[model samples]
Target: MNAPFGARGTALVLPQPYLLFLGDTTEPGFAKTAFGLRDWAGDKCVGEFALPGATVTTHLARMTPAQAYAEGARGLVIGVANPGGMIPPAWRKSLVEALEAGLDIVSGMHVRLGDIPELAEAAALLGRRLIDIRVPPAEIPVANGRKRSGKRLLTVGTDCALGKKYTALGLARAFRQRGVDADFRATGQTGIMIAGGGMPMDAVVSDFEAGAAELLSPDAAPDHWDVIEGQGSLMHPAFAAVSLGLLHGSQPDVFVVCHEPGRTEMLGTAGYKLTSVEEVVELTILLGRRTNKAIRCGGFSYNTSALGAEAAIALMARESDRLGLPVADPMRGGAAFDALVASCLA
Candidate 1:
């Protein structure tokens, strides 16, 4: 169970094998949630359910609510984000249909799923749940900046939605594969859903953001490793607070800076250029030292998905040699990934 606020646990347990719902999303960027689920938690996804005119697809078999329900899907996760996180009127019928088909609705929208009259009423009538993942706990404590026990590795990024969550997940999995006890601590809606529990770091109050991070990774066994999911970039003008708070609160002994290879500028921010890997490392250590004096860089997790095989390998090698730190694209695990994993444990 996840303790989203501070120390207490969650009742946000959602049903498994989700049917991703992309409601008329035409643009690929708008369907990030759907794509994330497919990429990270593909096994838990039964199929996709999209409304009419949705060009964006997960490439999974398309299924309606009835077909998805029959295929054993228990939840219909709202997989597209509009400008305001508001549910359009056009999406209600599809949501209600899912409820009638016995699949609960899971959403990460700013607006509550249960607050929407049509979806709420349908769920109430069908005895199905309307899970809203973005809601913070009732009470959250202010950060005390107290350091906790055990080892923690947090993933920091150059910008949002690159590969922080992916790297954390991959690292945690690799750690466990080597018989090391590690857990992936999720911090966002997509990650929270995938991990089955997590602190909604962005949803937390500014004062309690650090406190929530503290509770999110409490004192564990000395050998245990909590691989915490990273949030926004420190250089990002809008969302640096959450990143700072998580850094100060988690008090990680090691941190990995995640970055995309081709991003010239920060995602969604035109004029602001993406911070260099070297600069990110320097700033992370400077700011992160406030909470954990022994804090150090683990390595780099590069999103080299867009690069060719040879180019990706070459880039990773060049960066690793220059920085004197292991650099690996976790998706292409090799000697580089092995070295990266070794640095984390070292």
Candidate 2:
């Protein structure tokens, strides 16, 4: 397989047929890595392994590490985005089992798996590899604010787990269906793994976060659209800086606001009420215009997973009517995403 370009223009080629480990945190943020791998890697995803008590997503079968190894899993992927990227102690046994089975381990967490004594010893004894995708490039240049040709559409969110990457990818696919040349610029670990290229924005130093976005979506023809994946929310106290840097770096011509309907509070932060969709749209436009004054809101990508079929439909209709913009659950392959692409093209 051809190597995907890394953040620093280095080549990155992972072993094939990976076993994605989604332990406990099956929420969108953590489960996203598995979804991305399934979508992009296809046959390369041999199996998925989850903790015994963890709630698994629909259509994903949970396998043991030994079973995964027997079924042709060349590597074990720690796909969850746990806080601090630390591997939970309960997961060590499974990881150790995979290591003993001679499977290389790849993780996108901030915590390096190689630093853990037991796991490190197992890998050393077994001669298996440990790769951490979150490590920043050795060097990243600061943004120069240079203008580029091409229509750029960025997906900003009300919070971190709001589906910005999915929306961006869905819009890119819809644009391709319409015979438009478009590219999805991934900005996180899940997206990078899916797209096979892109910088993990949150892993970069503050000075070069935007610079990474700029590099991801370089100059293209005016008709081409760079569907850039956005990072965190402006209101998310912990991740707001990364979001702001991505906005300033992308310098998009148009942007889409993404939110999870009926999500009362921010993920992992109780009592923190989500901002109104309208408020988020306004904020995205306000921040986007700081780099490009002509920036406008293209539409909205709504995550209706928390709602049932009827409720999701009703909320979609209401949000569409209320916002007077196209709204879609991008993961569901809804026609509304086509409208969103049309809005961006307009």
Top candidate by TM-score: 1
lDDT of 2 by residue, 6-123 (tens): 4347323355578888777657656767777888666677778877677755245567777878888888887777766678898888899888886888888878988999999999
What C-alpha lDDT does candidate 2 achieve relative to the native structure?
A: 0.79
Q: How does each model score on lDDT?
A: 0.89, 0.79
User: Per-residue lDDT tens digits of candidate 1, residues 1-346?
Assistant: 2223223453246687899999999999988888888987888899998888989999999999999999999989999999998999999998999999989888898999888888878888889998888887666678788878889999999999899999998999899899998888989998877776677899888988898888788888899899999999999998999999999999999999999988878877758999898899999999999999999999999999999999999999999999999999999999999999999889
**What residue runs in model 1 are displaced by over 4 Å at the alpha carbon?**
1-11, 59-61, 70-72, 268-270
TM-score for model 1?
0.89
lDDT of 1 at 263: 89
Candidate 2 lDDT score at position 321: 86
lDDT of 2 at 75: 83
